[model samples]
Target: MLYWLMKYVLLGPVLRLLWPTRVTGTENIPENGGAIIASNHLAVADSFFMPLHVRRMVTFPAKQEYFTEKGVKGRLKKWFFSGLGQIPIDRSGGSAAQAALDTAIRVLRDGHLLGIYPEGTRSPDGRLYKGKTGVARVALEADVPVVPVAMIGTDKVNPIGSKMWWPRRLEIRFGAPLDFSRYDGLVGDRFVERSIADEIMYSLMELSGQEYVDIYAARAKELAAADAAGVRPAVPAQPSAPVAGDAARVPESKAS
Candidate 1:
C-alpha cells in the first residue's frame, strides 16, 4: 500500500538517517482497539515524525485545502497526503465542526488510531495552549482512550515557513492512556467537556514540560501579529473559572 511504501520504503529510511528519532511509551498504544493520539502541536513535521515512530497507521483530519489545491505541485501534495490516509474536513460553514466530529468518530468506530491536536493549532511560541473541547467530545462519544504524546525538537528541525527540514534529533514521548469512562453518559454537558479537556491538557503539560498558557494558541498568534504591526488589539476577556470537578482534574499550579 501507499502508506507502507512511503513510511517504510521512501521517507522512513531518509528520515531515520537524517533525524535519528527516539520514541518512548509506544506500549501505551492499544493493540486491538481504536484510541485517540492527542499530541502537542509544535510544527508541521510533528505529523510526520509521530506517524513514522508509531507502528500503526494514524489518520488525522486535515484541512480541506490540503486536498483541494490546484497545479502540479498541489497534485503531488494531494497524492502524498492522500496516500498517507488523511481525511479532509472542510473548515468553513456552520456545520463544519459537526462534520469533522462525525469523521473522527467514524474513524474510531472502525478500530483505527485517530491523531488529533487538541490545541486546534500549532503552538506559536513552543508553549502548550488551552485545548478545545472537541477532543473531549470525540473521546466520550467514541468511548476511546486518549493518549497524550509529546514531540520535542521538531520545531527546530522544521521551523514554521521553512520549506526544507534540517537534520536534527527528534524525541517523542507518549504518556499513559487516559480513561474518561467515569464521565460516561455525561456527553454534551459543557462543564463535563471542559473538565475533560483541561485534564488532557494537564497531562500534556506534565509530559512535554512546556509552560501551559491559559489562552488559546490562535488568539496568542493574533495578539503577536497585532503587536508586530503596532496596532492595539482588543484584549478578550479571560475564560470563565473552571468548575470544581475541573479544578480537581487540572491542578492550579500547572494551568497558571
Candidate 2:
C-alpha cells in the first residue's frame, strides 16, 4: 500500500515533471513472473529513475547502511527507502555476497522482479566494469531470465559526489531478456558461473557502451586511484627490436 500510494500520489507527479524519462523495450520485461532486471550502475539516480519507468514494483537490495541511521533523520531515511521496496542488505565483508545472493534468490522464487546492478557499485568514471558472478548464480539457481537494462544520461542528473540534482533528460533502455537454459545443470561449477557472468556483461557492454574491465569492482577502484595519482611506472622497452636488415630477411608466416 505504501509503495503504490507513494508512486501514485507523491513521487509520480514529481518524477513525471522533473525527470520525464523515456523507456524503450519495457515490454521486454515479463508482465507477471520471476525475472531479474540487471542494470548498469552509473549514478544514484539510476535506482529511482529505473523503477519509475517500470510498471511492476521492482525491489532492489540496498545496502544496510540506508536503514541503519540514528534519530529522526535516520528514521526518515529508512522509511523513504523502505517505501521504495528496497531490501536492506548487510554488506560488511566475506559472507555478505553469499547472503545477498540468498535473499535475491528467495525474492525470485517468490515470483517477483529483483533489480540488481551487475557492476556491484556505481561507476566512478562512468565505465562499466566486469560483472560479479552472483547475478548468474541467482538466475541459474532460480531458473529465470535476466533482463539487461541500460540507463543513459542519469549521471548528469545526480553524479557521484554532487549534493544537488540538475535538470537532465534520462533514457532507460531495456534490452531483450537473456536465457541461460543451456547451462541448466551446471550452476555450481565456478568456471561455468564465470562464463555465464561474462556473457551477461558482454550484453550490457553493447547496451551501455562503457569500457569493459576484466577485473572486479574492488580491484578497479585500486587501479583507478593509481591512475589518478600518476604513479603508473613505465615498463622497460623490449630488447628484441629488429634491425632493418633483419626485418627484410624475415620470412612471412602463412595466413590461416
Candidate 3:
C-alpha cells in the first residue's frame, strides 16, 4: 500500500512533472517473472528513475546507511526507502559482499525483478567502470536472464555533490536480456566468474557508450584520494611534433 501510495501519490507524479523522463526499449524487459536488470550507476537518481519506468516493482539492495540514520531525518529516510522495496545492505567489512549476494539470491528465488548496479556504486566521473563479480554470482546462481540497462543524461540532472536537481531530459534504454544458459551446471571457478562479469560489463559499455575502466570502485576511490593528496606523480606528456609523412604517423623505426 505504501509503495503504491508513493509511486502514484508522491514520487510518480512529481518526477513526471519535474524531469519528464523518456524510456526506450522497456519491452526489452520481460513482462513478468524473475530477471536481473543490471545497469551502470551514474547517479543516485538512477535508483528512482529505473523503478519509475518499469511496470512491475523492481527491488534494489540499498546501503544500510540509508536506513540507519539518526533522529527524525533518519526515521523518514528509512520509512521512505523501505516502502520503495529497497533491502538494507550492511556494506561494511569483508562479510558485507557475501551478505548482499545472499540477499539478492533470495529476492531472485522469490521470482522478482532484482535491480543491481554491476559497478557496485555510482560512477564519480560518469565513466562505466569494471563491474564487481557479485552481479555474475547472483545471475549464475539464480539462473535468471540479465537485462542490460543504460541511463543517459541522468547524471547531469542530479550530478554528484549537488543537493538540488536540474531540469533536464533523461533517457533510459533497456537492451535485450543476456542469457547465461551455456554456463549452467558448470563447476564454480573464480576465472569463470571473472569472465562472466567482464561479458556483462562489455554489454553495458556498448549500451551506455561510456569509457570503460578496468579498476574496481574501491581501488579507484583509493587512487582518487591519493591523487587529491598530491602523493601520485603527474602523467607524462605526449610528443608534440609529427613523426612520419603527411598522415603524421610515427615511423616504425622511431616508435621502437
> Which candidate has the highest lDDT of all?
1
Model 3 per-residue lDDT tens digits across residues 193-242: 56667778888888887877777765666777788899974221221221
Minimal lDDT window, size 10, model 3: 239-248
Q: Which residue pairs collide in model 3, if any?
A: none
TM-score (all chains, Cα) for each model: 0.91, 0.87, 0.88
Could you give me the TM-score of model 2 versus the true structure? 0.87
Best by TM-score: 1
* Candidate 1 residue runs with Cα over 4 Å from true position: 233-256
For every model in order, what is the number of clashing pairs? 0, 0, 0
Instruction: Please give the CA lDDT of all the candidate structures.
Output: 0.87, 0.80, 0.80
| Candidate 1 clashing pairs, residues 3+ apart or interchain | none
Residues 22-55, candidate 2, lDDT per residue (tens digit)?
8899999999989999998988888888888889
> Candidate 1 lDDT (Cα, whole model)?
0.87
Q: Give the distance in Å from residue 3's predicted Cα in candidate 1 to where it truly belongs.
A: 0.9
The digit string of per-residue lDDT tens for model 1 on 108-140 reads 999999999999999888888899999999999
